[model samples]
Target: MSMSTSSMSAMSSAPSAFMTPASATSVLISGAGPTGLTLACLLARQGVAVRVIERAPQPHTGSRGKTLNARSLEVLADLGLAGDLLAEGRTGLPFRRYFDGAFAAESDPSADTPPTPGAPYPASLHLPQDRIEELLRARLAELGVAVEFGTELTGFEQDGERVTARLADGREVTAQYLVACDGGRSTVRKQLGVAFTGTGEPEPAMVVGDLELTGLEPTAWHQWFGPQGALMLCPFGEEGDRWQVQATPETGPDGTALAPSLEGFRRIIARHTGRDDIRVHAAGWLSSWRVNVRMAEQYRVGRVLLAGDAAHVHPTAGGLGMNTGIQDAWNLGWKLGYALSGRARSALLDSYSEERRPIAAWTLETSAAGMAAVREGARTPGVGLEAVRVADITGLSLGYRGSSLAEDLLGGPLRAGDRAPDARCTDAEGRPIRLLETFAGDRFTLLAFGHRPALDPAALDLSAHLRTVTVDTDDPAGLRDTDGHARRAYGIEGDALVLVRPDNHVALTAPRGGEKAVLDYLARL
Candidate 1:
């Protein structure tokens, strides 16, 4: 599992992994965007050789998707980049909704109830896509991994054992697996001929320039649902006081196929704010994109798999697009690393599509509904007027179901496919630490409780290959109440041990006395 010096050099030299040798390329990820870069960093940390390819010459500076949920923050924390990101990024505090330029409802993320114990990250953070990429790139550089830019995957061929991708420069690189993080127009997805079944709703909105307001009071996020469609103004960061404004375009048929002009953008802003003197700084990024709700027919076609926008594309109403992609990579990265390291069976790869596709479908539907609500509000002023629930807008409620791991858990509260909640606990040294802090690095965790006299730790000797943390709890009442779902999910109650996967899902739960059963489970994996 050692990374070759040549692969390290390739990551530092090229924008894509095309220059890296096949022997050094265990995982070849196309597109070094957030999802691909995050996956590369995760694999590299685990001693897996990962090569990332991107068509863009360098990191994109556009103000694209700009919301990160608690789940995504947890994944970043695992990569050791969450602290830096939180410092650089702004928190979506005092969550508020505006109707016709009037405040409707508001709540603070920090004031919310603490998550059930054992969960990793429990709140959302607001960071622009560019800033997030910057953090991810910094992390990859720290791990001696760099994304190869200006490299495009022209074509690819997958065999029984590996996948070989042909680059635009006529270079061929082979790897054990090929992941497509290339955006909505993914060539890999098209090459596989997987149907992207979805329709686009015409949004005749011309979101104008990155303006720095003088008199406009800036809060968390301002959404205006007037007769003129939805106008959303979101704060980017402290520097320059950049704000992204989205409003309906007076010209064109529902704003379809109409180029966004600065003049057109200014008019929309003036119409909404009733101020024509607002100074425009610079149009950092501007484009009109109609909402497209679509998901790949399949996430995998042999060794070639799809992730991020390549797998699904939905409206930005809920800001779930980027977050969903990152989660996909987080789930797949560890599984691929473990399986490639010969610790798990190839069938483990099937779970990627099984667990992720449905989630993507749900995101698409949810985002579509949100967009429909917004559009309806635009058409019939204040028709569907209701406070935008934080869960709906944040995309935190999305979870996995219908997997073998989940199905085995039955209808218990802590069954498979449920997110493992976080809890506060004291370590051996009596130092207070969070359960997520235990999973900070990329590794698996095992939680053990109850009084079992003959439990043998040596039965799970894979510790050298896997990370194991055993929390021996004598007083069940001392355990975090949020752990009920975790206990039920693992089918463990009193005097039991539960093995958690790297993604924080329960892998196996066994009674504390049944060391043999636990050993058998590890051996099977």
Candidate 2:
């Protein structure tokens, strides 16, 4: 039977002790955080059956990932959630610091970040991680997929054919693959015997929580310098007068988790700002946060794979922990879907680990450096951008240049494996559009720019899944670089062809008449 037929058969199976009713999905995901939710939502959109389970009875209410960078905005834009997210987010908010209740220098954190034709999102956005998960969950619901809350993956054993996972409710779920997005202390990673190697920062653990308080302007992001550290109170979303507070108490250096209580919160608020009048009315979520710098040695072990916090954890320095994980899901989701549907071989799934692992390692280092700068009093809390550049912080500078999937041509600065930059171009009707719009949806897009194109749509034999847009030099076809923006952005002097993968990265670029080269590159990936 075909893979889709087999997948349907699995979903239609009856319940039993060894395999339960929920055992039918092709991919089983653990931990319904942003990472798992994104992966689940992506797969579901592609008609891949996925079962997502979270140990917690309810969705997390904490505002952990408060900043969504530019690349993350692009990822969300791909899911059609960017418009709603932008509506619910605050943008280009300034960061102001006060020392001893006296105003220090105020800095526009994202002032230097200008939107480009290809990259339209802002430097960063102020939407909480909880809100992001809500969006993903809503998308999943639209696809008829609901997260299985209160269901935890106790353990799982995998083989060549399938993976059988045991839930906390004494149920068994058999799936073609298993992915763990369950935080840093991942049970799946542990069970798979993946070595998580890193050291935990011994600095006194800090507390972060969301609170509804009075007497603070929700416009400017505030930071108060204290004897211990900088106290942060960032306003998120325009819905109400809510804020996320991060502060460290002067309690003796005891290795203990701080309890999130009203009294404790008030005390920290009073101690840090030396103000007793600011009312701490009620708290929404509270938790302890510490610097744990770690990464899994391998992203996959057999049928079990890891993403998000399950695979790596940073000090929340560059605000990249959540964004990187979201990108990870975006990278893995479509590939897994193709593999599950048998449109692509299982080798495509291997690229998930190979591509994401290095990015995670780089994120860990950059975030670690940012954390060190903050702890050393050289930078303000939540203002690590002083140490990190705009490109790195926005995650646009990252590319799989050395990736085996890339095929480079010595024409433009952007080669194969580079992110295909956006440019203002016109379609056949002379209507202006950006590359982001053209590359929307889950399909490989081929752009034949300016001349003797490497690939031909009429004569070429290609997969039915591929999308082709032809651009001409003199007699323009479907797409045209009217003002030579495409020529400049894509490095097309006379003639060139660019093949962009589903994730918006250039898979292969070749000189004119290199049609066979492009085909060979596609076959290899």
Q: Judged by lDDT, which candidate is best?
A: 2
Off by over 4 Å in 1: 1-24, 92-122, 202-209, 252-257, 379-398, 407-412, 452-461, 465-468, 472-493
Question: In model 1, where is the ten-residue run with the lowest total lDDT?
Answer: 1-10
Q: Model 1 — TM-score against the truth?
A: 0.85
Q: On a 0 to 100 scale, what is the lDDT of residue 483 in model 2?
A: 81
Task: In candidate 2, list every pair of residues with a backbone clash.
Answer: 118-422
Error of 1 at 317 (Å): 1.6
Superposed Cα deviation of residue 419, candidate 2 (Å): 1.3
TM-score of each: 0.85, 0.91
For every candidate, C-alpha RMSD to the true structure in Å = 6.3, 5.0
lDDT of each: 0.69, 0.78
Residue-level lDDT of model 1, residues 358-411, one tens digit each, is 888878877777776767765543332232233544344555645665433223
